[model samples]
Target: MPVHNMHERVLSMGSEEAGALLDSLSAGTADRLWPYDNWPPMEFDRPLSAGAKGGHGPVRYTVAAYVPGVWIRFTFTGPRGFHGFHEYAVLPVDEERTVLRHTLSMRVSGLARLSWPLAYRWMHDALLEDSLDLAERPARQARWSPYVRLLRALVTRVH
Candidate 1:
Protein backbone atom coordinates (compact mmCIF):
# COMPACT_ATOMS: atom_id res chain seq x y z
CA MET A 1 0.00 0.00 0.00
CA PRO A 2 0.96 3.60 -0.45
CA VAL A 3 1.56 5.86 2.52
CA HIS A 4 1.63 9.63 2.53
CA ASN A 5 2.25 11.24 5.88
CA MET A 6 2.97 14.86 6.71
CA HIS A 7 3.50 17.04 9.74
CA GLU A 8 3.72 20.80 9.57
CA ARG A 9 3.90 23.86 11.75
CA VAL A 10 3.42 27.56 11.09
CA LEU A 11 5.97 29.45 13.07
CA SER A 12 6.11 33.13 13.86
CA MET A 13 9.34 33.51 11.97
CA GLY A 14 10.49 34.52 8.54
CA SER A 15 11.26 32.04 5.77
CA GLU A 16 14.94 32.79 6.06
CA GLU A 17 14.90 31.99 9.73
CA ALA A 18 13.04 28.77 9.10
CA GLY A 19 15.41 27.95 6.28
CA ALA A 20 18.34 28.37 8.62
CA LEU A 21 16.82 25.72 10.83
CA LEU A 22 16.56 23.40 7.84
CA ASP A 23 20.20 23.98 7.06
CA SER A 24 21.12 22.95 10.58
CA LEU A 25 19.86 19.42 10.06
CA SER A 26 22.45 16.72 10.89
CA ALA A 27 24.94 19.38 11.97
CA GLY A 28 25.97 17.53 15.17
CA THR A 29 25.91 19.83 18.18
CA ALA A 30 25.16 22.76 15.94
CA ASP A 31 21.86 21.18 14.91
CA ARG A 32 18.87 22.80 16.55
CA LEU A 33 16.13 21.42 14.36
CA TRP A 34 15.97 17.64 14.77
CA PRO A 35 14.73 16.30 18.12
CA TYR A 36 17.87 14.28 18.68
CA ASP A 37 17.67 14.59 22.44
CA ASN A 38 14.58 12.39 22.55
CA TRP A 39 15.14 10.23 19.47
CA PRO A 40 17.94 8.76 17.42
CA PRO A 41 20.09 11.50 15.89
CA MET A 42 19.98 12.02 12.16
CA GLU A 43 23.47 11.54 10.78
CA PHE A 44 24.97 11.67 7.31
CA ASP A 45 28.23 10.67 5.67
CA ARG A 46 28.83 14.36 4.98
CA PRO A 47 27.16 17.70 5.38
CA LEU A 48 23.57 17.77 4.16
CA SER A 49 23.42 18.45 0.43
CA ALA A 50 22.36 16.72 -2.73
CA GLY A 51 23.74 13.14 -2.76
CA ALA A 52 24.53 13.04 0.97
CA LYS A 53 23.77 9.63 2.46
CA GLY A 54 22.39 8.93 5.92
CA GLY A 55 19.37 8.36 8.08
CA HIS A 56 18.25 8.08 11.68
CA GLY A 57 18.74 4.68 13.34
CA PRO A 58 17.60 1.79 11.13
CA VAL A 59 16.29 3.95 8.34
CA ARG A 60 18.64 4.79 5.48
CA TYR A 61 18.50 7.19 2.57
CA THR A 62 20.46 9.40 0.23
CA VAL A 63 19.79 13.05 -0.43
CA ALA A 64 18.27 13.10 -3.88
CA ALA A 65 17.87 16.84 -4.02
CA TYR A 66 18.72 19.89 -1.95
CA VAL A 67 18.06 23.61 -2.18
CA PRO A 68 19.84 25.16 0.76
CA GLY A 69 17.33 26.45 3.32
CA VAL A 70 14.37 26.02 1.04
CA TRP A 71 13.91 22.29 0.56
CA ILE A 72 15.48 18.81 0.53
CA ARG A 73 14.41 15.32 -0.52
CA PHE A 74 15.85 11.99 0.62
CA THR A 75 15.33 8.75 -1.20
CA PHE A 76 15.21 5.67 0.98
CA THR A 77 17.82 2.95 0.66
CA GLY A 78 17.09 0.44 3.36
CA PRO A 79 14.71 -1.44 5.64
CA ARG A 80 14.09 -3.61 2.57
CA GLY A 81 10.58 -2.52 1.74
CA PHE A 82 10.29 1.24 1.76
CA HIS A 83 10.02 2.42 -1.83
CA GLY A 84 10.03 6.20 -2.21
CA PHE A 85 11.21 9.34 -0.50
CA HIS A 86 10.80 11.76 2.35
CA GLU A 87 11.43 15.47 2.35
CA TYR A 88 11.33 18.75 4.25
CA ALA A 89 10.07 21.97 2.77
CA VAL A 90 10.02 25.55 3.98
CA LEU A 91 7.16 27.63 2.72
CA PRO A 92 6.78 31.32 3.32
CA VAL A 93 3.39 32.06 4.77
CA ASP A 94 4.00 35.78 5.13
CA GLU A 95 6.73 38.20 6.02
CA GLU A 96 6.69 37.12 9.64
CA ARG A 97 5.49 33.56 9.33
CA THR A 98 6.65 30.42 7.57
CA VAL A 99 5.40 26.88 7.31
CA LEU A 100 7.79 24.03 7.94
CA ARG A 101 6.63 20.70 6.62
CA HIS A 102 7.97 17.15 6.67
CA THR A 103 6.52 14.62 4.32
CA LEU A 104 6.98 10.83 4.03
CA SER A 105 5.69 9.25 0.86
CA MET A 106 6.30 5.59 0.15
CA ARG A 107 5.07 2.18 -0.75
CA VAL A 108 5.67 -0.70 1.63
CA SER A 109 6.12 -4.30 0.59
CA GLY A 110 6.45 -7.70 2.31
CA LEU A 111 7.42 -7.37 5.95
CA ALA A 112 7.36 -3.60 5.83
CA ARG A 113 3.68 -3.70 5.05
CA LEU A 114 3.21 -5.26 8.45
CA SER A 115 6.02 -3.55 10.34
CA TRP A 116 5.03 -0.13 9.11
CA PRO A 117 1.53 -0.28 10.49
CA LEU A 118 2.36 -2.26 13.60
CA ALA A 119 5.44 -0.37 14.74
CA TYR A 120 7.03 2.11 12.35
CA ARG A 121 3.93 4.23 11.83
CA TRP A 122 3.44 4.92 15.52
CA MET A 123 7.06 5.81 16.10
CA HIS A 124 7.20 7.85 12.92
CA ASP A 125 4.25 9.97 13.96
CA ALA A 126 5.67 10.65 17.41
CA LEU A 127 9.11 11.44 16.03
CA LEU A 128 7.81 13.88 13.42
CA GLU A 129 5.62 15.65 15.95
CA ASP A 130 8.62 15.99 18.27
CA SER A 131 10.59 17.30 15.31
CA LEU A 132 7.97 19.94 14.72
CA ASP A 133 8.15 20.86 18.40
CA LEU A 134 11.87 21.33 18.06
CA ALA A 135 11.40 23.56 15.02
CA GLU A 136 9.03 25.77 16.96
CA ARG A 137 10.70 26.64 20.21
CA PRO A 138 8.63 27.33 23.32
CA ALA A 139 6.06 24.98 21.82
CA ARG A 140 4.49 22.23 23.87
CA GLN A 141 6.19 18.86 23.63
CA ALA A 142 4.53 16.21 21.57
CA ARG A 143 3.26 13.36 23.70
CA TRP A 144 3.85 9.72 22.83
CA SER A 145 0.98 7.33 22.50
CA PRO A 146 0.79 4.38 24.87
CA TYR A 147 1.66 2.00 22.04
CA VAL A 148 4.56 4.17 21.04
CA ARG A 149 5.88 4.16 24.59
CA LEU A 150 5.66 0.40 24.69
CA LEU A 151 7.31 -0.07 21.32
CA ARG A 152 10.11 2.28 22.30
CA ALA A 153 10.70 0.26 25.42
CA LEU A 154 10.97 -2.95 23.42
CA VAL A 155 13.39 -1.43 20.92
CA THR A 156 15.47 0.00 23.73
CA ARG A 157 15.84 -3.41 25.31
CA VAL A 158 16.84 -5.11 22.08
CA HIS A 159 19.39 -2.53 21.01
Candidate 2:
Protein backbone atom coordinates (compact mmCIF):
# COMPACT_ATOMS: atom_id res chain seq x y z
CA MET A 1 0.00 0.00 0.00
CA PRO A 2 1.16 3.49 -0.70
CA VAL A 3 1.87 5.75 2.20
CA HIS A 4 -0.74 8.41 2.75
CA ASN A 5 0.31 11.55 4.51
CA MET A 6 -1.33 14.56 6.02
CA HIS A 7 0.85 17.41 7.10
CA GLU A 8 -0.26 20.65 8.66
CA ARG A 9 1.71 23.57 10.03
CA VAL A 10 0.72 26.83 11.63
CA LEU A 11 2.55 29.84 12.91
CA SER A 12 2.76 29.44 16.63
CA MET A 13 2.94 32.42 18.97
CA GLY A 14 6.55 31.74 19.97
CA SER A 15 9.08 28.99 20.59
CA GLU A 16 8.32 28.95 24.31
CA GLU A 17 4.59 28.90 23.70
CA ALA A 18 4.79 26.32 20.93
CA GLY A 19 7.05 24.14 23.01
CA ALA A 20 4.54 24.45 25.83
CA LEU A 21 1.75 23.32 23.50
CA LEU A 22 3.80 20.28 22.51
CA ASP A 23 4.32 19.62 26.21
CA SER A 24 0.57 19.68 26.70
CA LEU A 25 0.25 17.03 23.98
CA SER A 26 2.95 14.93 25.57
CA ALA A 27 0.98 15.00 28.81
CA GLY A 28 -2.15 13.94 26.88
CA THR A 29 -3.78 17.21 27.91
CA ALA A 30 -4.66 18.57 24.49
CA ASP A 31 -7.96 16.86 23.85
CA ARG A 32 -9.77 20.08 23.10
CA LEU A 33 -7.95 20.16 19.78
CA TRP A 34 -9.58 17.01 18.49
CA PRO A 35 -12.33 17.63 15.99
CA TYR A 36 -15.18 16.33 18.12
CA ASP A 37 -15.39 16.56 21.87
CA ASN A 38 -17.78 13.60 21.93
CA TRP A 39 -15.24 11.06 20.71
CA PRO A 40 -12.65 9.38 22.89
CA PRO A 41 -9.62 11.60 23.28
CA MET A 42 -5.95 10.79 22.51
CA GLU A 43 -3.95 9.53 25.47
CA PHE A 44 -0.86 7.64 26.53
CA ASP A 45 -0.59 4.71 28.90
CA ARG A 46 2.22 6.58 30.56
CA PRO A 47 3.46 10.09 29.91
CA LEU A 48 4.11 10.90 26.25
CA SER A 49 7.64 9.65 25.72
CA ALA A 50 9.48 6.87 23.99
CA GLY A 51 7.85 3.49 24.78
CA ALA A 52 4.49 4.76 26.04
CA LYS A 53 1.49 3.02 24.48
CA GLY A 54 -1.75 4.85 23.73
CA GLY A 55 -4.29 5.88 21.17
CA HIS A 56 -7.88 6.97 20.87
CA GLY A 57 -11.03 5.27 19.61
CA PRO A 58 -10.16 2.32 17.33
CA VAL A 59 -6.66 3.54 16.59
CA ARG A 60 -3.83 2.35 18.79
CA TYR A 61 -0.12 3.09 18.72
CA THR A 62 3.08 3.22 20.70
CA VAL A 63 5.36 6.18 21.19
CA ALA A 64 8.18 5.33 18.81
CA ALA A 65 10.35 8.33 19.65
CA TYR A 66 10.27 11.72 21.27
CA VAL A 67 12.32 14.85 21.79
CA PRO A 68 11.06 17.18 24.46
CA GLY A 69 9.59 20.42 23.08
CA VAL A 70 10.71 19.42 19.62
CA TRP A 71 9.00 16.27 18.34
CA ILE A 72 7.10 13.13 19.30
CA ARG A 73 6.26 10.15 17.11
CA PHE A 74 3.62 7.48 17.56
CA THR A 75 3.79 4.27 15.58
CA PHE A 76 0.43 2.74 14.84
CA THR A 77 -0.54 -0.66 16.15
CA GLY A 78 -4.18 -1.07 15.37
CA PRO A 79 -7.28 -0.83 13.21
CA ARG A 80 -5.54 -3.92 11.87
CA GLY A 81 -4.22 -2.39 8.69
CA PHE A 82 -2.37 0.80 9.46
CA HIS A 83 1.37 0.60 9.09
CA GLY A 84 3.21 3.77 9.96
CA PHE A 85 3.42 6.65 12.35
CA HIS A 86 2.24 10.12 13.16
CA GLU A 87 4.14 12.91 14.84
CA TYR A 88 4.11 16.48 16.06
CA ALA A 89 7.03 18.85 15.97
CA VAL A 90 7.91 22.39 16.83
CA LEU A 91 10.34 24.15 14.51
CA PRO A 92 11.73 27.48 15.53
CA VAL A 93 10.87 30.07 12.93
CA ASP A 94 12.51 32.89 14.80
CA GLU A 95 12.65 34.31 18.31
CA GLU A 96 9.03 35.40 18.28
CA ARG A 97 7.52 32.58 16.28
CA THR A 98 7.63 28.86 15.71
CA VAL A 99 6.15 26.44 13.20
CA LEU A 100 4.07 23.77 14.82
CA ARG A 101 3.64 20.80 12.50
CA HIS A 102 1.61 17.64 12.72
CA THR A 103 2.13 14.80 10.29
CA LEU A 104 0.66 11.35 9.67
CA SER A 105 2.41 9.02 7.33
CA MET A 106 1.20 5.48 6.86
CA ARG A 107 1.06 2.57 4.52
CA VAL A 108 -2.46 1.26 4.61
CA SER A 109 -3.53 -2.26 3.78
CA GLY A 110 -6.64 -4.46 3.97
CA LEU A 111 -9.57 -2.61 5.54
CA ALA A 112 -7.46 0.49 6.05
CA ARG A 113 -7.30 0.99 2.32
CA LEU A 114 -11.04 1.49 2.39
CA SER A 115 -11.36 3.19 5.74
CA TRP A 116 -8.46 5.56 5.39
CA PRO A 117 -9.66 7.06 2.16
CA LEU A 118 -13.40 6.77 2.64
CA ALA A 119 -13.51 7.88 6.23
CA TYR A 120 -10.41 8.50 8.30
CA ARG A 121 -8.49 10.76 5.97
CA TRP A 122 -11.06 13.52 5.94
CA MET A 123 -11.56 13.46 9.66
CA HIS A 124 -7.85 13.41 10.29
CA ASP A 125 -7.34 16.47 8.15
CA ALA A 126 -9.98 18.43 10.01
CA LEU A 127 -8.68 17.28 13.37
CA LEU A 128 -5.12 18.35 12.61
CA GLU A 129 -6.17 21.74 11.33
CA ASP A 130 -8.18 22.30 14.47
CA SER A 131 -5.18 21.22 16.52
CA LEU A 132 -2.97 23.65 14.67
CA ASP A 133 -5.43 26.44 15.41
CA LEU A 134 -5.24 25.64 19.08
CA ALA A 135 -1.47 25.60 18.89
CA GLU A 136 -1.76 29.20 17.76
CA ARG A 137 -3.99 30.70 20.37
CA PRO A 138 -6.75 33.23 20.05
CA ALA A 139 -7.68 30.09 18.17
CA ARG A 140 -9.51 30.57 14.96
CA GLN A 141 -12.44 28.32 14.27
CA ALA A 142 -11.80 25.40 11.93
CA ARG A 143 -13.78 25.78 8.76
CA TRP A 144 -15.13 22.29 8.62
CA SER A 145 -16.30 21.20 5.21
CA PRO A 146 -19.65 19.46 4.98
CA TYR A 147 -17.81 16.18 4.44
CA VAL A 148 -15.79 16.68 7.59
CA ARG A 149 -18.90 17.62 9.55
CA LEU A 150 -20.66 14.52 8.35
CA LEU A 151 -17.72 12.32 9.27
CA ARG A 152 -17.56 13.91 12.71
CA ALA A 153 -21.27 13.35 13.22
CA LEU A 154 -21.13 9.72 12.21
CA VAL A 155 -17.93 8.80 14.00
CA THR A 156 -18.84 10.57 17.22
CA ARG A 157 -22.29 8.96 17.24
CA VAL A 158 -20.95 5.49 16.52
CA HIS A 159 -18.21 5.73 19.10
Candidate 3:
Protein backbone atom coordinates (compact mmCIF):
# COMPACT_ATOMS: atom_id res chain seq x y z
CA MET A 1 0.00 0.00 0.00
CA PRO A 2 1.12 3.51 -0.67
CA VAL A 3 1.34 5.88 2.27
CA HIS A 4 1.49 9.61 2.10
CA ASN A 5 1.37 10.82 5.65
CA MET A 6 1.94 14.44 6.48
CA HIS A 7 1.77 16.66 9.55
CA GLU A 8 2.36 20.37 9.68
CA ARG A 9 2.16 23.26 12.10
CA VAL A 10 1.78 26.90 11.28
CA LEU A 11 4.02 28.73 13.69
CA SER A 12 3.75 32.34 14.67
CA MET A 13 7.39 33.04 14.05
CA GLY A 14 9.59 34.16 11.24
CA SER A 15 10.91 31.60 8.75
CA GLU A 16 14.43 31.98 10.07
CA GLU A 17 13.29 31.26 13.61
CA ALA A 18 11.29 28.26 12.45
CA GLY A 19 14.17 27.09 10.29
CA ALA A 20 16.39 27.21 13.34
CA LEU A 21 14.14 24.61 14.92
CA LEU A 22 14.69 22.28 11.96
CA ASP A 23 18.44 22.88 12.19
CA SER A 24 18.38 21.82 15.81
CA LEU A 25 17.15 18.33 15.04
CA SER A 26 19.24 15.61 16.67
CA ALA A 27 21.53 18.21 18.18
CA GLY A 28 21.72 16.50 21.58
CA THR A 29 20.64 18.75 24.45
CA ALA A 30 20.26 21.60 22.05
CA ASP A 31 17.64 19.81 19.95
CA ARG A 32 14.42 21.77 20.29
CA LEU A 33 12.27 20.09 17.63
CA TRP A 34 12.23 16.30 18.03
CA PRO A 35 10.21 15.03 21.02
CA TYR A 36 13.14 13.06 22.44
CA ASP A 37 11.90 13.41 26.04
CA ASN A 38 8.84 11.22 25.38
CA TRP A 39 9.99 9.18 22.40
CA PRO A 40 13.07 7.52 20.93
CA PRO A 41 15.67 10.08 20.08
CA MET A 42 16.70 10.62 16.44
CA GLU A 43 20.37 9.77 16.36
CA PHE A 44 22.92 9.55 13.57
CA ASP A 45 26.50 8.28 13.23
CA ARG A 46 27.63 11.88 12.80
CA PRO A 47 26.20 15.37 12.72
CA LEU A 48 23.06 15.73 10.61
CA SER A 49 24.03 16.05 6.93
CA ALA A 50 23.76 14.14 3.72
CA GLY A 51 24.80 10.48 4.22
CA ALA A 52 24.25 10.43 8.00
CA LYS A 53 22.49 7.22 9.00
CA GLY A 54 20.02 6.78 11.84
CA GLY A 55 16.41 6.67 12.84
CA HIS A 56 14.31 6.53 15.97
CA GLY A 57 13.67 3.14 17.56
CA PRO A 58 12.91 0.31 15.12
CA VAL A 59 12.89 2.54 12.08
CA ARG A 60 16.12 3.23 10.23
CA TYR A 61 17.05 5.52 7.39
CA THR A 62 19.87 7.45 5.77
CA VAL A 63 19.98 11.14 5.07
CA ALA A 64 19.53 11.18 1.30
CA ALA A 65 19.46 14.91 0.97
CA TYR A 66 19.93 17.99 3.14
CA VAL A 67 19.87 21.75 2.85
CA PRO A 68 20.80 23.36 6.12
CA GLY A 69 18.01 25.32 7.83
CA VAL A 70 15.72 24.60 4.87
CA TRP A 71 14.93 20.97 4.15
CA ILE A 72 16.12 17.44 4.82
CA ARG A 73 15.05 14.04 3.49
CA PHE A 74 15.71 10.53 4.72
CA THR A 75 15.38 7.29 2.78
CA PHE A 76 14.25 4.22 4.65
CA THR A 77 16.63 1.28 5.03
CA GLY A 78 15.20 -1.09 7.59
CA PRO A 79 12.41 -3.12 9.30
CA ARG A 80 11.65 -4.58 5.89
CA GLY A 81 8.93 -3.37 3.54
CA PHE A 82 9.33 0.36 4.18
CA HIS A 83 10.41 1.74 0.82
CA GLY A 84 10.57 5.47 0.34
CA PHE A 85 11.46 8.64 2.13
CA HIS A 86 10.40 11.07 4.82
CA GLU A 87 11.33 14.70 4.92
CA TYR A 88 11.05 17.95 6.86
CA ALA A 89 10.64 21.25 5.10
CA VAL A 90 10.37 24.86 6.10
CA LEU A 91 7.88 26.92 4.14
CA PRO A 92 7.52 30.59 4.85
CA VAL A 93 3.94 31.78 4.91
CA ASP A 94 4.95 35.35 5.51
CA GLU A 95 7.50 37.42 7.36
CA GLU A 96 5.74 36.61 10.66
CA ARG A 97 4.50 33.13 9.91
CA THR A 98 5.99 29.87 8.71
CA VAL A 99 4.85 26.32 8.10
CA LEU A 100 6.91 23.43 9.38
CA ARG A 101 5.93 20.25 7.62
CA HIS A 102 6.91 16.62 7.96
CA THR A 103 5.98 14.23 5.17
CA LEU A 104 6.26 10.44 4.98
CA SER A 105 5.92 8.98 1.52
CA MET A 106 6.35 5.27 1.05
CA ARG A 107 5.03 1.92 -0.07
CA VAL A 108 4.61 -0.82 2.52
CA SER A 109 4.90 -4.49 1.75
CA GLY A 110 4.88 -7.76 3.76
CA LEU A 111 4.17 -7.36 7.51
CA ALA A 112 4.65 -3.65 7.39
CA ARG A 113 1.41 -3.29 5.47
CA LEU A 114 -0.30 -4.63 8.56
CA SER A 115 1.93 -3.18 11.29
CA TRP A 116 1.79 0.22 9.67
CA PRO A 117 -1.95 0.82 9.69
CA LEU A 118 -2.46 -1.03 12.95
CA ALA A 119 0.31 0.30 15.18
CA TYR A 120 2.93 2.45 13.51
CA ARG A 121 0.39 4.90 12.15
CA TRP A 122 -1.02 5.73 15.55
CA MET A 123 2.38 6.09 17.18
CA HIS A 124 3.81 8.05 14.25
CA ASP A 125 0.94 10.49 14.26
CA ALA A 126 1.28 11.14 17.96
CA LEU A 127 5.02 11.57 17.71
CA LEU A 128 4.75 14.07 14.88
CA GLU A 129 2.10 16.04 16.75
CA ASP A 130 4.35 16.13 19.78
CA SER A 131 7.22 17.34 17.62
CA LEU A 132 5.06 20.08 16.17
CA ASP A 133 3.95 21.10 19.65
CA LEU A 134 7.56 21.55 20.61
CA ALA A 135 8.02 23.87 17.65
CA GLU A 136 4.78 25.82 18.16
CA ARG A 137 5.23 26.12 21.91
CA PRO A 138 1.49 26.27 22.46
CA ALA A 139 0.28 27.06 25.95
CA ARG A 140 -1.77 23.87 25.97
CA GLN A 141 0.03 20.66 25.14
CA ALA A 142 -1.19 18.14 22.62
CA ARG A 143 -2.71 14.95 24.00
CA TRP A 144 -2.07 11.47 22.69
CA SER A 145 -4.98 9.13 22.05
CA PRO A 146 -5.73 6.21 24.37
CA TYR A 147 -4.56 3.76 21.71
CA VAL A 148 -1.28 5.60 21.45
CA ARG A 149 -0.84 5.47 25.22
CA LEU A 150 -1.44 1.75 25.27
CA LEU A 151 0.89 1.16 22.36
CA ARG A 152 3.63 3.14 24.04
CA ALA A 153 3.22 1.09 27.21
CA LEU A 154 3.41 -2.14 25.24
CA VAL A 155 6.51 -1.09 23.33
CA THR A 156 8.18 0.07 26.55
CA ARG A 157 7.53 -3.34 28.10
CA VAL A 158 9.11 -5.12 25.16
CA HIS A 159 12.18 -2.93 25.14
Total clashing pairs for each candidate: 0, 0, 0
lDDT (Cα, tens digit) per residue for candidate 2, span 1-159: 776566656574677777777777634445434434534678778876899998887889999998877888899999899999998888888887777778788899998899999988887777777777766667777788999898878876876
Candidate 2 global lDDT: 0.77
Candidate topping lDDT: 3
Candidates ranked by lDDT, best first?
Answer: 3, 1, 2
Whichever of 2 and 3 has more lDDT, that candidate is: 3
**Candidate 1 at residue 140, lDDT?**
69
* lDDT minimum window of 10 residues, candidate 2: 26-35
In model 1, which regions exceed 4 Å deviation? none
The whole-model lDDT of each prediction reads 0.93, 0.77, 0.93
Clashing pairs in 2: none
TM-score of 3: 0.97
Tens-place lDDT per residue, model 1, 38-134, is 8899999998989899999999999999999899999999889999999999999999999999999999998999999999999999998988888
